[model samples]
Target: MNNPKFEIFKAKNGEFYFRFKAGNGKIIIISEGYVGKPSCVNGIDSVKRNAPNDNRYERTDKTDDYRFNLKAENGQVIARSSEGYTTKVNRENAIDVVKKEAPNAPTEDQTV
Candidate 1:
């Protein structure tokens, strides 16, 4: 079975970001771009620390889809859903998966 992991990569803009992928290889959560890789890694650490808290999730429903943001205790948005879900159930499921996977997910340094 594929293991859920955090992949850190550098964007073309020279910023770094990290994405949490589920065991199925679907990206569930992605951090905002950081100017440095260390900051991006810290973002991933924050996600692992905050993901299990239900209150940290800020859910939204747009006209066509549902989305969510994972926030740190300081109220900073650590990560956001990779894509809007077509249904509320799907969005919740994605959040649940992140909560379950993030804490133990190993980091894959793709920034090399």
Candidate 2:
């Protein structure tokens, strides 16, 4: 869909997931899991514009040389994995992070 609120993607293991901003700069997960590609695609909006919004998550917040270590509001380290890794394990890590933040999302329902 073209909705800016959320996007569904298939993980490398052929599992699917719904992801979106939790309004408070958080990310929420709506689906259990469905692996599609070998990994997750960067947000299309940020990619097409060549200006990856700071609000949206990106592999390299600083530059290509460095990767991101996804962190939660309470200082809990979520997914230290980067988008550069397209392995199933990496995709799973991303999902785990999304799930952790999803429950506390202000704009989305907690899947529990």
Candidate 3:
């Protein structure tokens, strides 16, 4: 099985962001842009430390789809899953995958 991975890139707006991708290369979650690369790395660290905890997940529904946020201990949203899960179970499974995959995921710099 392929391990999940995090890709870091410089956005067009010149900010840095990281995206967590599943083993098959599907992006499972994306993070907010940061002004500096160090901050973006910190965000990745936050996800690694926080994604495994059930309490750090905040679930919500948007119209017909379910979405969730991974939050840090201080309540900042570290990353957010893409919307469109039709059921709560699927959304929870997505979160579970993040919990399972994030800790050992490798980081790739795609800023070039």
Candidate 4:
């Protein structure tokens, strides 16, 4: 299995954001932009801590697809699945995989 990683970067608008990548370098999730780098880092930490918990995920349906938001303990959305899943089971399994991968994922600062 490929070891996943989190890549942090600065957006064109100068906000900080991050994406979680699978070992194959495929992005699995993308976070919302933060005004500061520290806030972005905290979002990453929140995802790592909360992804493993089923209760922390808020499932939603968009059109015909399903997606989920990983939320912090405070109920703030930290990160979201990159692509909509075709089935609820697939969406839930994707969350389970994120829970397994995120804790051990290394960080790569691409903000330069």
lDDT for 21 in candidate 3 is 92
Per-model TM-score, in order, reads 0.97, 0.25, 0.93, 0.90
Off by over 4 Å in 4: none
lDDT of 4 by residue, 4-101 (tens): 99999998998999999877677778999999999988888888888888899899987769999888899988899899989988888778778899
The candidate scoring highest on lDDT is 1
Candidate 4 has its poorest 10 consecutive residues by lDDT at 20-29
What lDDT score goes with residue 93 in model 4? Answer: 76
* Prediction 2 global C-alpha lDDT: 0.38
lDDT of 2 at 49: 29
Off by over 4 Å in 3: none
RMSD for all candidates, in order, please: 0.8, 13.1, 1.3, 1.5
Cα distance off (Å), candidate 4, residue 4: 0.1
Better of 2 and 3 by lDDT: 3
Clashes of each: 0, 9, 0, 0
Q: Rank the candidates by lDDT, best first.
A: 1, 3, 4, 2
Q: Per-residue lDDT of 2-112 in model 2, one digit per residue for the tens?
A: 222444555566564555553344443333443442222222222222212223333443323334443433443333332344454454455444444433333222222
- The TM-score that candidate 1 achieves is 0.97
Model 3 RMSD to the real structure? 1.3
Candidate 1 residue-wise lDDT, 57-107, digit = tens: 999998769999999999989999999999999999999999898999999
Candidate that beats the other on lDDT, 1 or 4, i.e. the better one:
1
On the 0 to 100 scale, the lDDT of residue 39 in model 4 is: 91
Residue 98, candidate 4: C-alpha displacement in angstroms: 0.8
Best-to-worst order by TM-score is 1, 3, 4, 2
Global CA lDDT computed for model 1: 0.94
Segments in model 2 whose C-alpha atoms lie over 4 Å from true places: 1-19, 22-85, 108-112
